[model samples]
Target: MPIRMHDTLRRKKVDFSTIEAGKVSMYVCGVTVYDRCHLGHARCYLSFDLIHRWLEQSGFDVHYVQNFTDIDDKIIHRANELDGDWKKLVDENIETYYEDMDALNILRADDYPRCTDYVDDMIRITADLIEKGNAYVADDGVYFSIESAPEKYGMLTGQILENVRSGAGGRVDDTGKSKRDHKDFALWKAAKPGEPTWDSPWGAGRPGWHIECTAMSMDYFGAQFDIHGGGHDLRFPHHEAEIFQGECHTGCSPVVHHWLHNGFVNLDGEKMSKSLGNFWTINEILKKVDAMVLRFALINAHYRSPIDMNDALLNDAERNYNRVLECYVTSLKGCLAENNVPLPVADFASTNPLSKSLALLEKMGEGFAKAMDDDFNSREAVAKVLGAVREIMKMHNSDMDAVDSNAFSHYAIDWLEETAGAVLGVLPTREMALAEPEEDPRKLEIADEVDALLLARTQARSDKDWAKADEIRDALHQMGVVVTDTAEGPTWDLA
Candidate 1:
């Protein structure tokens, strides 16, 4: 199946088609760079990262661009509150952003255009808007005239232009003092006292919040691009303004072919916010849980679905993650056994248990791909992965005497580690996922006891004493040990 995604503009799922064949130009709206990234940020970026990985896997060469609003009211205010320079504050947070995202294993964008770096480009676009009569220069700044393009002004948000007003959050100070229309958003802001200023035709002032994205995206991907995405909060004024300014300046009909927005990260049934005191920063969460566990938790749900952040969610993710890891480690150990035999290819057509198991493992990759292709539905794709693991475990435990365990292990391990791991961006390496926990002397003593029980169980089974074998297995279970009897030996793990 071809890739199908929900476009926020159209508000429906549509088949995705890039402007350029076999290539995708994607621009995801980035952070403001004034504070540490939180779980909401992780949700947004990881959703796009999933898309990026899937695109690459689907044979599309994706050129992704994400920008940073290094200069903003938030940054300036945060700097004042911290008694630090605005640039220094942005720099610190940008570095921390990288560290946090890298920890989550989000793929880096091809270009990260800072707002301050593209002041010249912003000024040029602002000037062009004025020359085209799409924007007007006010006493304080340049504002994009919403009246200039009435039909396309509110197309993105599906709001009537007449009822739209400025100052709807993330809007520039469009106080009705000098603007023509209340809906007219700021393209450029005039210089303020003691604030970062850039040289422009209007005066030494900085670019507006929405204009920076238009400038940077156009600079990187030209007038039109394949996909523009951000959090659902941006669907309104921030992205709406991008569509207005981009099309008006470039004289293009559609600025971006598809608009993707990931849903919010809710905390305990409420939206996460700093003021509400429900916000959990990525760094803070990482200190408690494994990074891959967090990534798995975030991706376990559909990207467009709101994920509830809580201890329960993390715990569930850790449990599921351990199940996958256990299967992978078991497969690796079985494959590395010296006396294991390979299943014959000629026997594949026969009704042999090993051949049936191998056939199931081979089809898992296609199942994974099919799930991803349907709107990048990661939740379903992850289900397929876990389903494959369950099948592998059933074969290992129930069909061990009839199947070639080594052959099944080789195929399952490669598919889980290479194919599924590549797009999921988790469980890539064995050491990371399956590393042994630090040995405790007390636990070591328990391990010796568990081994002795397993040895007795094996001997009982070999001596045809079924009742004794069952008794030993019951003792191991009571001691919190889960033992699976195989043809080679009994594999034990802590319950």
Candidate 2:
């Protein structure tokens, strides 16, 4: 089945097709590079990261471009707030953006075009809009006339010109009285004192927020592209404005094939924002929890559904992630011991427990694909993977011990790579996860103590002394060792 997505323009889940066959050209609105990224940034990028992964996994060539608004009002204000150079601030913050996103395991975009570098392109587009009578100059700067592209105005957000109120175009003083309509937005702003300025046809000024995206995206991807995405809050004035500007500039009605906007990341029950003083930076939260835990919590819901982020959610995600990791580790270890990977389905022709469990694992992988195919339903897809791990544990403990463990081990790793590692992107590959972690001196010192306790637990179990086994387990916990007894035996990790 063809992939489907909820297009913000059509406001419906439609069958997705690229402008070019077997290739996907995507453009996601990037950060303003004014500060360290927060949870909201993670949500937006991860949502599209999953889409990028699935498209490539489905055999489509993906050329993804994300723009950086490096010269925005926010960047200038932030630079002034810190009494620092705007260029230095933008460079430092761009580095911080990569740090935060790389920690969360998001795949980097194919290109990151900064607005400052694209001033020439912005000038060209604004000049063309003026020549075509789609824009007019004012005392302040050039503004795009909404009347020129009336049909494309409400194509995304459905807010027509008649319903547009004063100051709805993202300016403070209503475009300084030269704007044709209250809804007319600035394509270029005339230079202001003490701010960065670029030479443009309109004047020596800067490009507007909305036009930066239009200019960079059109310059990178051409007249039209597939899969334009951003945060849901960008739906209105930001994305809505991009529709008309790109279409009017390029003479293409639907400049972007599909518009996808991921929902917000709410703090507890309220909206998370720096203005509200309730948001947490990505680095800040990662300090308290693992990056994978935060990644899973952020994506545990539908991409278009608002997710409440809190400590409890992170804790739950940690537990769920551990459950899968533990199973994968156990299975991979078995494969290593057997010195072989799982063979083809034809090799598992018997109706024995091993073959049956492998069949179930294959079905669960299909279930994961089914969930993801229906509009990238990652929440349901994660549940399917968890179910596969649970089934693996169930089969290992009861009936699979007598059969060859090769198929189970290799199939388990394959399923996880396809589902968790590929689509969800929440975990690393099986080899990486099973690789010996960097040896800490503290853990090394306690290895002997852990072994002694495990030996005691083993002896207790052999003697049917449940009480002593429980006591040894408690002692191991006090030593900062978390031990779980699998069908293969006991596995312990430093807590």
Candidate 3:
């Protein structure tokens, strides 16, 4: 099946095609470099990662670009709030961003153009807009006249120019700023006392938030590209501004063919926000679950659907992740067994366990592709993977070593690596996925406490106080200890 995806601009699913045949040019808006990346960032980036993986697996040459806003008001404000150098803070946070993102296995973009590096390009673009009568120099800075190209105003948000929100990439305040029209946004901002500044024709100031993206994206992908994506929050002013600047400057109506936006990360039915204290950084969540488990949790839902992140979602992810990992390990074990017999059934269509299992595996493989083809439906694709695992689970270890089990084992290995490992990116090596988890030193010190609880439970059972015994057992469970009565006394271990 050909790939079809939900285009945010058209507001419907359509067949995905590239400007150049067999090639894709994609740009995903990147972080502001003011802080660590949180779960919301993970969902957005991983959503693109899933799309990138599938495109390559389906045989398209994908050239991906994700930029960094190393110079922004937030970065400067954060630096001043912490009494640190803005450049140093931006550098450290960009380093941390890569560390956090790489931990989740997001593929690096082909180009990472920093906004600061493209100031000259932005200055030229802003100057050309002014020369062409689309922009004007104001006391504050150069502002793009919305009235010059009002037709591009409501392309993404569907609101007309008069009714559009004054949300221009988080630039809300109009304090002491001069503009010809109230709706006009900045092309360059006049330098402030302590903020970073660069030389431009208008003044010694930096480019505006919207113009940086226009300069950088056009520099890489010409005037138009295949896809432009970011978090759902960026669709309104940021992307709309990009379109306004790009099309007005290049005399092109549509600058990008597809505009893709991932849904927000919610917490307890509310949008996750730092103000609400519902935010969780990617590093913080990594301590609780395996990286692959986190990947499974985030991408388990469709890319365009809201993911209400909570413990329930994570627990389900860990359970399903273990199933896939265990099946992979079992397949590896079967292939490595020394005394395995390689049956020479060249046609291999006889009615046996191996033949039936192979047929089912082939069917599941097709199902996985079909689901992935339909807008990267990872939820259904994962079900197809678990479906294949079920088929393998029904076969015993010895049966996997049966007549033509080698073919089944090899087939399982290849199927998982291609579909799950390469496309979904939820599959990793068994050793890496099941590596020895960090042991808590505090857990080692709980042995004496566990012994006391077990002794009390034994005494309660001897006294026919069944409720007391059950209560004691529950207490142990609260401490993450599991107990089972053996022919000897009860044996205990951490759950």
TM-score of each: 0.86, 0.88, 0.88
Give a tens-digit lDDT track for model 3, residues 429-478: 66764466676777779988989989999999889999999999999999
Per-residue CA lDDT of model 2 for 114-187, tens digit only, reads 98888888888888999999999999999889888787777778886677676645555434467767688888
What TM-score would candidate 3 get against the native?
Answer: 0.88
lDDT of 1 by residue, 27-105 (tens): 9999999999999999999999999999998999999999999998889888999986998899999999999999999
For model 1, the local distance difference test gives 0.86
Ten residues in a row with the worst lDDT in model 2?
Answer: 339-348
Ranking by lDDT: 1, 2, 3
lDDT of 3: 0.85
In Å, residue 457's CA in model 2 sits off its true spot by 11
How far in Å is the alpha carbon of 458 misplaced in model 3?
Answer: 14
Please give the lDDT score at residue 195 for candidate 1.
Answer: 85
Let me know the TM-score candidate 2 reaches against the reference structure: 0.88
